[model samples]
Target: MLSSILTGIGEATQLSALVANLVGVIVGITFGSMPGLTFSTGLILLLPVTFAFDPVTGISLLVGVFIGGMTGGSVSAILLGIPGTPSAAATVIDGYPLKQKGMAGKALGMAVIASIFAGLVSLLLLILVAPLIAKVALQFGSVEIFALVLFGLSTIISVSSGSVIKGLIAGIIGLMAMEIGLDPVMGVHRFTLGYEPLQAGIDLLAAMIGLFAIPQIIKDLPRSQGETGIKIEEKGITNQLPSWQEIKSCFGIMVRGALMGTGIGSIPGTGGPIAAFLSYETNKRMSKHPEKWGTGILEGVAAPEAANNGVTGGALIPMLTLGIPGDPGTAILLGALLIHGLQPGPLLFQNNADVVYGIFAALFIANILTLIVQWFGIRLFVKILQVPKTILLPAIMVLTIVGSFAVRNNLFDVYVMAVFGVIGYFLERYDFPTTPVILAIVLGPTLETEMRRAIIAEGTYTAFFTHPISAVFIFLTLVMLFGPTVKDKIAARRAA
Candidate 1:
């Protein structure tokens, strides 16, 4: 193990690896800080470019992008009050509030610190536990996978953050949307509406772009005439790093967020958003003064920031160990690996030990570089908030349209993006959260396919409860869905 680690370190220190890692991080941060462009979008865009590189170098580059993108989202979320990626949505809750309080520097500093700390913690855990986790994952049957999907879907309650009914509606709509592609078991087309493009279903990229980006574009249009879309003052922003006292106050929050992020990220289909939300809410619950939440506290900024970045390493665990992607970003990373004639699994670990260890080394370096890059480049990113909303919105719209088309070179996807953009706008206008819809879209196909497989294998739905792992997941899912509400009710009754 020591020799392999050293050899991997040597491989990762090569000139190509270093250059690729740096370039990927720069591009990722750019995409992540820009509205309508996510880390996944950036990865998709860079897929073809990586085909020419060797496995170790190529995967290293993508890993750098993954880490950088996750951290970069907080930049825009704090400065502009708009999440550059869905993963950063939780950061916006308190991040922008701090910006409004003329603590933009402090907020961004805390975000970066928390991100680096959580990222390192998760990366270490991944290095130590991924192989063992993969061994266990090998035993997961269709029933277990179905239950896992159910567990992931349980996060809808936390993500909803407002109306459970609307969240459920959005989730159902997202699930129904995925049904347009094809029936996994029967191969029958259900909701194509006679459109050929519908046969392929809505592209995930298009849906993501439309649902998150377009709504922001439309909302910002009305503010184009103003000096800035958000009216927060940005002066006296020097010394962005947090004080020792502040760090001491937020230490527990950061640790908790990191653990939550790492745990959720290891589960396939659960992404940074779930971790971020869970971390934020959990921190709030644990805080001595919960009422002060959403009022620009450093703890709030730290928790979600830590969780989202912690997801970078956590999501990679399953992706590398079981060939199962933890989120869209890892899914794209998996594609990159396959493109280099590399498969991620236990066998790959044995056959390509150097490459595997090289990836670990590169990720460690990338996280360190991310801290340095963001620290130096933050001033420039903050200046983006001063850009006029008119120019910014149009630019963002054009980029999203191009990105939607770029995924499959399909004009149909661009149209799908437009349609969903309209849908997202209305959803937002009506106060329905779009995150649930996006989450459902991501997990819908997996849930449907796995459930069908589980039923076929067991010949009965009740078998889901018979398997110990599946049963545990099912129990957790139920608790996640209703546990908070029940607790709240009990507390209310006691207060009365």
Candidate 2:
């Protein structure tokens, strides 16, 4: 194993491979930090270029892009409350609050550090125990996945700290919005209202941008001239690392996040957003001050950042080992591999161990580079916060509109964004939480599709409760939903 790793390292260090990896990282980060363009889009755009490169160098480039893109999205999520990629949605929970509180540096620092740590942890696991983990993940069926989505939905309680009922309402609204397109099973149009554009469904990126970004812009526009939105001092901007005590405190949360991300990532079709939400909820439940979760807590930044990046390594396991793309990004990576005359699976690993190891080695290097790049460049990113609302808000508005339209080049998506923006503004005015809305938008389709598939295959709903994994997830969902109330009751009784 040591010799193979060294050989892979040697191959990855060649000049062409090194240059390709660096270029990929820069390009990936550029796409990821911009609203609407995701890592998968970047990979798809660059696929034609990789055709001329060797397999090892080509795959290494894609791997670097994958790592850099995941690391970059949190930048915008923290600073602007706009998730550059779907994976960064959970980061916006506490990240924007931290920025508002003059701790943008701390939030970015934690995100970068957590991303690097989780990336390495997942990479190590990918190299050492990928086959074992993949084997276990393969056991999951539609029933288990449905239960898993339910478990993710149950975390809305943790995210919606102050108003559980409002959160549920927001979640329901999001689910209804997603239903505008064709039904997943029947292929029948349910709620298009006869609009041709609605036939394609509400685009998640557009809806998310409108839901999160437009509300902030609207709020900023009404501020008086003398009122400060975020006070920034040039001298105060420092990329100071967290205190050792702080780091020690969060180490466990980071590890748990890494594990959760890796496990979820290895499951095909389940992506980083699910992992990020799950990890965030787990940390919130385990924290002594659960009430502080959405209020700029460091643990809040760490969990999602760690989990999101961890998905990069985890997603690759199934793709490389089983020839199954774990998510859309990996599906593009699979195409890149096939174009290079390399098929990914057991036999490919045997015949082309060097290429496999080279990709792993490239990921390690890419992560290290991401840490360095983000650390030094963070101040520039943070400076966006210092821009006056007059200029900044308008730019954000334009970006939001452009991003919405860019998803599929459909102008109707921009209208969807406007409608969602109005809804989000009203929701915020009424003190309804928006995270649940985003969460529901993300999980609703999966839940409905998987549940339908499970029932059809089992001929009854009993499989959901009879399958051990599915049952375990169901139990966990119940615990997540009701555990806090039970605890409060116990505390009240003790006081009495």
Q: What's the TM-score of each model vs. the native?
A: 0.73, 0.59
TM-score of 1: 0.73
Q: What ranges in model 2 sit over 4 Å off?
A: 1-119, 122-132, 226-366, 378-385
**Model 1 ranges with Cα > 4 A deviation:** 1-66, 69-114, 224-226, 229-236, 239-362
What count of clashes does model 1 give? 0
- Tens-digit lDDT track of model 2 for 1-496: 5676678888888888888888788767765765555766566445545656777777777877898889889978887788878889999999989888888788888998999999999999899876564456556788977887787676677657578889889889988998889999999998988878889898776677677677767775744566544444455456768878888889999999998999888766577899999999999999999999998988999999999988988888877775655455775676577657776655566667777788888989889878877788767645544445576457667777776776667788889988999999999999998767876776678779989999999999799999999999899888877888999999999999
Please estimate how well model 1 matches the true structure, expressed as its whole-model Cα lDDT.
Answer: 0.81
* Model 1, span 187-273: residue lDDT tens: 888888777778877877677777877877777566434455434354756547899999999999999999899989987657899
Record all residue pairs in model 1 with backbone atoms less than 3 Å apart, i.e. clashing.
Answer: none
lDDT of 1 at 490: 100
Give the CA lDDT, 0 to 100, for residue 71 in model 1.
Answer: 92
* Alpha carbon lDDT at 139, candidate 1: 77
What RMSD does model 1 have?
A: 5.4
